[model samples]
Target chain A: MTATATNKQVILKDYVSGFPKESDFDFTTTTVELKVPEGSNSVLVKNLYLSCDPYMRTRMGKPKPSTALAQAYALGQPIYGYGVSRVIESGHPDYKKGDLLWGIVGWEEYSVITPTPDVHFKIQHTHVPLSYYTGLLGMPGMTAYAGFYEICSPKEGETVYVSAASGAVGQLVGQFAKMMGCYVVGSAGSKEKVDLLKTKFGFDDAFNYKEEPDLSAALKRCFPKGVDIYFENVGGKMLDAVLLNMNVHGRIAVCGMISQYNLENQEGVHNLSNIIYKRIRIQGFAVFDFYDKYSKFLEFVLPQIKEGKIKYVEDVADGLEKGPEALVGLFHGKNVGKQVVVIARE
Target chain B: MTATATNKQVILKDYVSGFPKESDFDFTTTTVELKVPEGSNSVLVKNLYLSCDPYMRTRMGKPKPSTALAQAYALGQPIYGYGVSRVIESGHPDYKKGDLLWGIVGWEEYSVITPTPDVHFKIQHTHVPLSYYTGLLGMPGMTAYAGFYEICSPKEGETVYVSAASGAVGQLVGQFAKMMGCYVVGSAGSKEKVDLLKTKFGFDDAFNYKEEPDLSAALKRCFPKGVDIYFENVGGKMLDAVLLNMNVHGRIAVCGMISQYNLENQEGVHNLSNIIYKRIRIQGFAVFDFYDKYSKFLEFVLPQIKEGKIKYVEDVADGLEKGPEALVGLFHGKNVGKQVVVIARE
Candidate 1:
């Protein structure tokens, strides 16, 4: 057996301008020793799955002080994101060889990581699908939990509206709202996603936003009373329309603005006066902020998953070469569900 | 005195579009009984000081289900707003002849009101100028109180920004933030108002927004560490700039959008994605929502006034004839401070 292996990586060509193209990412090959450095508390892992998220688009943009949560991806370097991996070697006290984990990892076959608590998690439940770590049981799960329950401050029998409904976070947010006994409605870009929301995810109502000329009228139709909680996944015109349709004292938990991420200049939201008129609360949040609540989230959602009370779907793209297209497809709403790029089966 | 007295009134000529003008208001005189009808459970009040507030502009717009916290002013009818008045006659158990109160009253010489608790506050501390009830002790006061302390959730040593800083609510917000030990910066339309913000309102820094070509650059210059709490009065471009300059987990208390109220199509606020990037919370609120906290607010600010620790400034427009210009001048940023139209001194 060789001590080193060839590692393939996806590297950003340059900082993106408008919408990112698949060609913006280039593949590179390098050889690396499959061992952690002596006396270093880092862990070496083999990448299994890489999660494609809307926030990734933000990271692709030109680096600025005001750029959201994640720092901009460096040119000619392998982009890192939430991924499932198996430890090849461990110098970290908490992890051991063959231990599965999920966290910010390079989009390469093998990479060394300084395992920080919360940022990286040693997967305990191998009972569930290990690839679920890239999505349902990982960052997106925590995001939906914190944003819907905490930020939204939801109540039973209230109405909820989720945009990007069939995506990793939105799908879970809809289910969580329903479990809380709230009437949940969702908007997705495709008819297939809309169907998934209504049929598979248990959303009370779902709409293909592309089919609706007037988003405000669509929201009014879906929520005859008014939207009490808006899980904002898409920004721009959708946000403007939602502002007009929101109920008095409505809460908008902004998890992501997928639509605005790719635009050079973000669309101007005009119905902001409705914010004051409705006494609405629009809160923007990141998953990193609520990492502490992860254990409690796992406790709540694990049972639901085991009992079939909860469901998760993923659009898996096989192999490292397909990573760029899988990610770039997210902005186009080409993925029907959670987009995950699989590098290895085991 | 005659049983019937001629009552002079400022009437809304029609529903206003674009910038409101003095011509939008028409004055008329009609006979009033000067006494409440027997068993009517109402009080007849002789108007003294009428408040000219920016939110009143929303009331003049064509009525819609989403017309903010106020109803539209009916054409050819007397407009109603916060005013201080002396009770000429009373059938309500809560009020008596010669009692002074402040509430929603007709913009007329004498008005009959069915006094509701909290909506109408009887003068308890008459030593302070009675006209103050139209501003410092009234609705705008409560607005500043609720928005800054409760919504902003300010911490000591936080950075606070106030827009339209020389106006009624903005002045109070700056002062309150200063009292909370926050570093306060404010933006006003003119040089004189900017000086008033720093000197009279005790704002740490002040800028004339009209002179600055780039609002965001001005904010960055003032808030080097970024704004922790923003008391949003003027919306549109100012709000967009504030969003860019907000610190992580910043709170924006949206009180009024005077800039957008007069426009046929409201300006689009493009920086909303910052809500998530910075984890910002933008809350829209009304004074009506916080009336329950009135006594608590009074207890907090009344002592400050009595000790001369707090100072209030008002640009007084004398006589009922000047009420039209006084109210309309608010949109033009012509009023130096809290704009008040005095109908009678006693």
Candidate 2:
């Protein structure tokens, strides 16, 4: 093994009780050997882009019951999420010192990962911004693809409504629905995000839910025909309102419930009775279930990104020291788009 | 036209707002000429057994936006529901005088009807009790079969949890799950209903939800392995607890939400976040959607009924005057089994 190098990490101070604060994570430093362990097929990686996702809020909570949604971030341990990393040393034949990959890695400057096919996908066609791997091409991309097509079972010309429209998964869902000849409407928290949804993401209509007193009335105004598919990102009140406006035989793809996460008490959904009256199908899914379709997702989305047919926006925070703020900002809806912490521009 | 007969009818007094009282309906007399009009395909029938169901509550409310669910029962009109009748006159070739049919009928002693294939099922196998058509071997039977097999997608040895497990659809769902070799557990309002779920319906275990202080704890005690499929009958808090107890990728077939139907304020479901974490699928379905499978269903269930593999109990009210009490009894859990109002025996 070569000489050890200094590694900086963002550590979870403890399990969060309510809305997460930046103080919940502390900056720390450790030393790591540059070389892969002897007789092990692990790859030593230098982290480039670390994703700050709404799902991480769930991990911040005390580990109560283990769920497929996410594993709890251990107290006093480095928080982990999807990231773009360059291999610095390789013990596996398929990976080398220069190969780029996107997968689960530590929220730190360096990580040694067991490069299993399931967790990691090789970064092919890196001509597009490498940071795209953190949002558009990584977990969020598969989430948008699988949640919309497989779970929602989208039909052409169907009306789609997306909540948290400016976030990582929501933006892509609107674009995909629009591309498939759907009339898409989206809801976000800010005027700027709402504008971006309509202009950049090409949503047929967009509204700032925070500005609207009655979400059901807002939905009624935007979608006179009623929502056929709802790509749910923020749950609670948004879900309840969407339920009231859903068409018969509607589909709701529960991708994330950002609004409910980190709350001591989750907002109760009242309009669930509408599900029976409308024959609605509300399905909850994880992108992990569709990782097997990553190649197919890449095949479809890469060209769209290259041709400027698909667009992605990011809110980038510099250095591991700013990681806490970037992750915490998600709860406050501070970030305009996909939030990422840049460890280094490898 | 033959001599007119005085028909006793149950008419909706007005659109119900909250919980329906017996006064929501009025007993009245209407004269009916028991003859098929010239060149009309409508059948004139003597209504026998009238089904008192939870879904009728939806119809009792004033019409809102149209849904594929039950149509609203108009004010001052005779309320209609599923019933068994003997055809007194028929203009359609498919039916003739003396033929027994079961389907949608007015809550009256006699009704003249246009009977389409979708609205009527001719009784082919009457070796069993004729009143079974008002409960099992009718809409509730098809509901249980389709909701369990098609929606829940049961596999042998899977843990099944059903609410309202001694009611019409719940009883059959538990029994069907048991027949499929599942570990079935059910919840009902009273000790009698709970006991019926275990000893009579063959559910592996049962609990009286009213007796349990904490339903989630009861479910945990009953299903330490967690629920694989939840047949949701009475929704609200029961659904909230079930969400917490659901296994990964569990399915919840939303059959009815009797608890929420009549309240001026519907109960908000709190634990829906578990859906995303568990990758659960909650689907609302109507028995009308699976009517085409009626033939196939009868073929599967008829032998079970004859050989006593399946058992159904009915709480029968003797007259049309008692229809309001029989139907209203469902909400208070007064009926031990399927509640039916017998307008006439033959």
Candidate 3:
């Protein structure tokens, strides 16, 4: 790269409060050289697929003193997330030109990555859909695996509950629990998602939490004996209800709390006393910390995928301009399955 | 064995709301056969000491329609807790007449117990004060050991924070953390408790949270870098503040939430998102669950006690009549250390 060139990007227009609107993000095109600068240990990569996640909503807001995990996206910088890409040019010794990798990349068509070795992982298995690297083979996949196996420590014949059931991580978690001989139940926002949980993902039971006025009662009806583990994705009233229906020594693996992320004030869980009395273990985990186990996760999940033991669905929005809307769609449960933005097919 | 004479005891008067009063528990006398009925595998024991724990306050209230864990206390029954006793008569094969043991007995003078061998452990170490069976040598001891070692998974030089610092389990936890070369700080309700934490228990630093209006500031002042392990006994606002000051990968062993027990409605923790940000592990544990590790615990703690490396404090009230007051005082933060009611010295 001769001079620093600007890249076309989707910039966060303003901080979001409750539900993110289309006006919150702006897509503008600018020219940039798709190559690494001289004497720099960096690589220029064209973005292939961008992962749309609910956690990205937290980054769209102004940085509050109390906000945990991620910083707010700057007013005009490109919104970022996990993306699958190809290295077009390389300045680092380990990475070479035309190496495929998946890690943190920008929302634009091309990103100049400073090749942080710890953050990026080189792609080994290319047989699976490259978009699978955006989800089932990537962050969401590891999240479901580690959050279930390590945090939940699920036992066979135990009753398992997954909220946001048809979403990326929730769908996989429900499947994983079922494979372990658990009685899996999931709650989604719509009839379609609920039906998908039972028919597509093999959940023992599925319910539309939106239609159920009494969530706790619905949980009781589904799990007469009480739930042994809860995969908490959508926090708030659902969390409060699940707490009431959890069996003694129940484990809650908190992967994401999408319901509370966008709210001005987070909902209070009234039945937290259950945690003490029933000896329930509620643990929060990040997939980044579980990167060490990624290879092991791949070893386990890859074979399952090859044999059709595991299946995945993607809701892909084409073009960089649609990236902002696709990312925002996650907060409102707009995506049918794994919401991914396809910047390029190859 | 013969029919037992009438025994006087304190029974829960009614379901409690807000702060408990002495009048909530009525002192009454009731008749019962001390001997185990023919062919019944049960033991009758005279309660020697009664333990007053903060958790009992939750049990005294009206049961919420939520979790089975929050079962309401039955009216007119003697309040129950861990009590050290001598076996007066036995039908159980494992326990003989005059055998000393510690387990769930009753608030009254004598109890006919259906011995659950797994729960009731034999008092092997008679060298220590038998009343220590009510606390440091009993449930509280196992709680501190298991919560610190198993839940916290502490390392040397790690920063540890204990809430309710001078109470039964908190005192031992602080000492255990200290013994492991952890930088230990604790929070209590009173100046006396703060002093006890520093002088008697050897806490690295101590603060009276009641006096400190800004808990986050206090935590920041004490732990500039942030706390690695937080032993949570008190919940509500304290928990909210601690969340802000927790270091990444922090482990929180939730033993009790005494602050929320008496509140008619539970307080919402505002900073729960910090758990995700910090990748904190918050696990709720019951001492009863860790009974299997008691033998191992005794093996570790007994040596330390014998070598004068470990010390303990007890706040004992004489006579069974004061049991109600002793138990109620826990909520008010009146007890200096392990609060025990001694029915008789000999």
Candidate 4:
């Protein structure tokens, strides 16, 4: 129990501005004793999988008062986000050694979690892959569920459009919309992702936005009736284009604005005028708000996953050193599905 | 029954592009037959007052697919809008001669109207001034009512920010927030309008946005706690500023974007990412959509108007010929309050 091991971590070098580069982070190693600080309510866990998300880009920036929506990720520290882990030791009564958990954890080989409110949740079901906790059974999953079903107020047979459709959240949203008998269309950045959305996720249609010189024309070609519910993952020009193509009384659930995250100046949405006549509603929601229904969500989504009614895709990169590339690949649409970095099998 | 008379009318010369001007319209005289087309359901009325609104600028634009929210006004024809009138002829079973009405009518000394859905609501109460029908009892009133009470979902003690705060709709919105026990603050274009907001309209605080170098700083001064509900009328930079100051779970009821209407390039809003952690909702609604709730709205607002709980200000201009000047003045914030043109006092 007193033996020490090398703890490898990916640390942010400084707060970023403009497009994030791999050099923004440094891979460093430190020594750790296999023991929890005595009398502290912290749980020591061996990290299994690390999730890569677009929202992490926002945290990498220097904090602004407006960025208070989510607390800014502190610089010169190991980046923290959703991760799957195995508890090796515990000072908290609710968690014991050998228990599994998923929630916010540092991007490292091992993490000592001082549990904070809404920070972590005990893992009950292990029949599913542990890495699922980093994705489909994780924040992105809850985001798709709440953003699509609740914020979108989707009705069966309505047309649903998801931008960044092959990313972690978009893939699930399109699948959920299809499950509800919706006419689902997704726009991805690359041909492979677009094809994956149509063939694997069963979207009614999919388009590569990069290929479509005019997004409004591309949307018109995809959904002639216009989008009823838009799971808005990418903002900027896509949003302006979607505004022009929405139907009367449409709802846009702004889950993320991936496109605008890296730029110093976010692209302005010009066609917001369409929101008035179309009686449109554009609302931004974070998954944390809907965490109270996590159990309800698990009960609803688990059976579908087990029954093969839902399929999840993960772009897995092995080892902690690969963290920077996996995280940076997200901003470029370099990965095809849920981006995850595997630290260990245990 | 067939006698003809010279009727003074304000006609649009052509579609407008940029800020509207007085030259965009022409003052002319035309002949009215003083009789409805034989056996038709048309009603001939002598227009008493013509309402000038910012939305009319959108109507003056060359028709685009998005302008389809409200039908565009035809060029080479007398412009039409909400007006107070005395019925001189009627072929519909709903009314007969000498009846008073407030609804859509041509901006002329006399107009012949064919009743259309949502275009007209029969005036059941006239104890209030007939000119009140053009504003306080008409679209702007309903607009403020539905946009605040219905869309805002306002709660007592919540903070509300109303832009264009001394205009026809903004004035009423501030009053309604006050009556609801909300802390209300309004921003107007001029010092005079700002004074009116605090003193006459019962706003807790007011600001002359034009005088403030930074709108965000002005808003922070007026609402240190952050805005709970935003009544968005003047969009562009003001909307961008408001977004930066909205509280968590705040709602923005987008009424109109008057500042963007006459511009060839609409200004872009940058701080929309605030919607995420703040969990803010921005919804666009039109009074026409809530017409089914008209009876309910009148039941709620009529007593307040009669008891002097609500005070309305009108910037009355003389004659039908003043229509162009009055209408153009709105783009420049020329009118102090509700802009109305007196076609004929009767």
Candidate 5:
């Protein structure tokens, strides 16, 4: 006879439309064997923390061809996302009991996963907060690393403008630009986030996008010399404005368009003709494409974290029951920084 | 003593709005000395053939910061464009009397221009039709070479799509992709142009965009594997449609936006989010940036022309008096190929 334990999970009620609310998710409890099945490569894990990301919103929409990158969440099932978990039992050769790892796992108290390359990254440095694995050490961290260094091809003294600059990925991009000796400005939805960008993220300048009447005018005021690189996060009107302000031979690394994910119809961008006039290059990328460099990313970032040269902030929700509200709050800009749902501390 | 000649010219009436018409341009006759000024570096030339291109539309607009690349055409002055000319007098060291060249010159019978490195190129291969310089060997040819080869980065067996397929630049782009062993498709405004693309230009398939109700569906039908490269000549709705049908890691080279250049307000492009999902790279370039590679371009194309492997077509307007109607006809899709105003044969 094998040992068994109760598993609590946050389940999706149905395919979501428009802005997702807490009502779109439900809770369920089930019993599972604490041990991995005989002769299986699966590892049974106890979920510690779950990441609340803007990309998760794309997964909530009804199944469609465009959202093929991230598959639609299955109805009446535990929604899966990047999470930090501890292996309770394992039949996989790479993982043993008590091994820490972060990757895609269900929104639950316990999960059974088959470890695969990129699907799961084994944690080596436990000296830092394990919760950081859900964000600054996980997918969002790699996104900032690859999107900024690889895609943006940043150079010293160049002007970098990041929209959604106080969020998980944006905050880190701003810091990285600062580290590279770039002149960085960020835009956030709230005054508090704007302050955090300047004070915490070390941005040269920060603006509350919600307070600005005209985005183009705001950009013109901030970047009088014109923008050399744009880290595009919030699309729609912001992208249109940034296009007008981009310098000749400028580059735009498109990571996310959070502003348009919830809308039934995405907004139309009018100033794309500037792409021609300014001889701009716009490239889109997904973090998964750069996961192979996770080890190199950790090498670059972990040192800064330990030296206190880099700072990170988390708006964490306690317990699995709070996961629904935490994830939904991301769309409303209710979370101040990297939003995480804490399931269990150890 | 210098000889004088009657210089018949076409002058812009004023900054244009909406669609430009023949009435927007007025005729002027001025007597000019057929010689470069003493102690001046300028070269005097008799304009033989003036090339009518879509980009000239931007110059006709009211002077603004955005149109800084090509300065607005001076109001009530003879408009300038790429033209084939015979030098009658030269004070510059590089050019001499009786030399043929292709570069920017006024839409007049005679022009005195100070030729710069990129502004003028001395013609060497005159075995082909001299008119070819106005279209195939001139600025439009260089635009196609740089935009397709450097920007698109095409690989063999990729599916390529070109808009405005029978025009000067687009025609060359389609043929270049075919030469690279790629499957090429093109879209034009009329059946005649479509037939020319499939038969004359060797495109795998061709479509008349004006007849297609759903542009995306039409693309899906033409490219069952999705478009790997998009030569963006006409912007607005076509760009939005191309975004939906782009393959993963596809590339788009934005050469021109003839469809939107005449509009007071450019049409907003939706579906830009596809850039992220598809990991697409959209790059805009000006041929002026690639002028240094003109010799390599000539080396590549001259042999093809000599071997009868290249073909070029021109819709020649008879005289300087017909320049206004010929240039304006491009907006109405009335010209079948490269439009040229022939002021003189020799």
Candidate 6:
């Protein structure tokens, strides 16, 4: 074991409301061991590529009575998120030095993970770009796969609608549905994303939801027959409008509700009555619940990636210092595809 | 063949806004045929017990662009709901004179149904009271059975919670959970209903939601370890509170949101974030979607009913004149149990 040393970390300054600022996280140096401690069941990881997910925005807020997924980030503590990392040292038997893994790691590069590791997986298939593990082959990829297949239960020739069409999960979901022989439509905030969804991701149709004044009418125009399945990534108004245009027995897979994450006051869904009237099924699911199927997902997705049957697009920020901006960009729809921050290439 | 004659019917006077009034419906003497006309594949039936469900309140309003299940009732036309009826005559090959069926029927003494006769099912189980067709062995029964068994996926020794506990669906859900060896808890509006849940329906615990100042605390008291399955019949504050007390991987079957039905603005759910952290699955479902399982449900529930392993309660309001009030009573938690209006006994 190497000698213990101090490390620098980025700690959450305070809980945020609405949109978060860079000042919300403070970069500070603190003493820490570079090596794993003796007899400890922990690993020392150096985060390479940190994922900027929209859901992390909710974690920046104060601990509420019912924040979904996990507890709020503690004040003055290192804020953590999904990151692809190299294990510098390991005291646990399952992992060894130089082994690669992707899991929850602190924002600042180094982390000491103890007792409960959040959805950690060993990187077995290294043929793809390592950064691909940050988005396409990691949490976001699993989210799109499980949420669409397991939750939405898409059928061939069905009309599928996806919100946040160019985001990590949304883009993949639309593509997967299209591959399943479904008529897929996607909604984005900008014309750029709309084009990417239609041309790049191969969505049957794509629209800029921000440009449309009447979302329900826009949906009706896109899906004259009504949407058979909706991949709900952005909640609030989009959800309300989608409820109106959902066909009888439509299925909605609630992956994440980006629109409501940073709001001081969450938007109310007005057309919930459609859930009963149309006999629609709206289900909220987390990727972790489908971890048992991860091996199977990898078996399926990896071949597609290798064969060029599946294409992934990423908006990679250069450094860890720009991580907050990359993350906040998700809310404003600035990131065109999967928002990721590459702290280091090697 | 019997001569065709117009029959008297009950019509919605106008669209209702908040709590419905007695004047919302008018029983007008209109003539209807006792027999189906030639060249039309339709059925003419004499309505027996008309079900006064809380969902009917939504139909009293003007046709919104997105009402899910049943279409909005046309102004000056008779309101319709689930009912048990005797097929007096039929032009459809599937039905003939004197066939007993239960399905969508006018809130009057008779109705003419056409085009789709698949929604209607012949009454195979007749040992129980025919009024059971209005609830158990009908839509509400299938709702309780499917919503609990199919959606919630209860396991033995799991903690289950049912809102609107003494109502048509909730009562049966609680008893079904108990039969499955689950620790069932229920919430109702009044002490009588609460007592009925515990003493009559075999719920492990029951509370009057109206009396509880803190719904979350009440849930904590009932489920010290947290609820594993929640049958959500009443939405709004109850849903918000239940979110806080849900165990990891908990399942919530959204059967109905009766609490938010009449409100001009739907209540915002403040605790939805719990859904992500606890890995909870909140799914909205309708009984109609589970129609394929109707026979299976009857096979399961009928024997339980015969053995007195399951008990059902009904609040029967006599005459079509009291129907509007009885239907509206559901929203305010005024009805003691399953609110039903007996149009005729024989």
Where model 1 places Cα greater than 4 Å from the true spot, the runs are none
Q: For model 1, which pairs clash?
A: none
Candidate 2 structure quality by residue, lDDT tens digits, A15-77:
998989988889889999999988899999999999998998888887777355777899888
Off by over 4 Å in 5: none
Which run of 10 residues does model 1 chain B get worst, by summed lDDT? B61-70
The residue-by-residue lDDT of candidate 2 on B247-272, one tens digit each, is 99999999999999898778989898
Please tell me what DockQ candidate 2 reaches.
0.71
Model 3 misses residue A229 by how many Å? 1.6
True contacts kept of each: 0.82, 0.80, 0.60, 0.73, 0.69, 0.57
What tens digits encode model 1's per-residue C-alpha lDDT throughout B7-82? 9999999889999999999999999997777779999999999999998898898899865467898999999999
Where does candidate 2 stray beyond 4 Å? A66-68, B66-68
lDDT of 3 by residue, B1-346 (tens): 4666788788999889998999999988988787888898999888899999887887888877664554577899988888999998899998999888998888998888888855687898899889988899899989999999999999999999999989999999999999899999999999988998999899999999999989999999999989899999998889888999999889889999999988888998777777777788888888877889889999998889898888798999999999988888999999999999998666
lDDT of 4 by residue, A40-114 (tens): 999999999999999999899888888766567777789999999998899998889999889999998889998
Interface RMSD of 1: 1.2
Worst 10 residues of 3 chain A by lDDT: A1-10
Q: What is the Å distance of residue A252 in model 5 from its true position?
A: 0.7
Residues B1-346, model 5: lDDT tens digits = 7789999989999898999999999999999998788899999999999999998998998887855466899988999999999999999998999999999999999999999889999998888888888888889999999999999999999999999999999899999999999999999999999999989989999999999999999999999889999999999999999999999999999999999998998899989988988899999899999999999999999999888788777888999999999999999989998999899986
Please give the lDDT score at residue A106 for candidate 2. Answer: 94
What lDDT does model 1 reach? Answer: 0.92
For residues B236-319, what per-residue lDDT tens digits would candidate 4 score against the true structure?
899889988999999999889998998888888787788775888999999888888888888888898889999999999998
Candidate 2 chain B lDDT trough over 10 residues, lowest sum: B62-71
Q: How does each model score on TM-score?
A: 0.99, 0.98, 0.94, 0.97, 0.99, 0.90
Q: Stretches of candidate 4 above 4 Å error?
A: A1-3
Instruction: Give the Cα error of residue A176 in candidate 5, in Å.
Output: 1.2
Docking class of 1: medium
- Listed models, DockQ each: 0.80, 0.71, 0.57, 0.74, 0.76, 0.50
Query: What fraction of the genuine interface contacts, i.e. the true contacts, does candidate 6 reproduce?
Result: 0.57
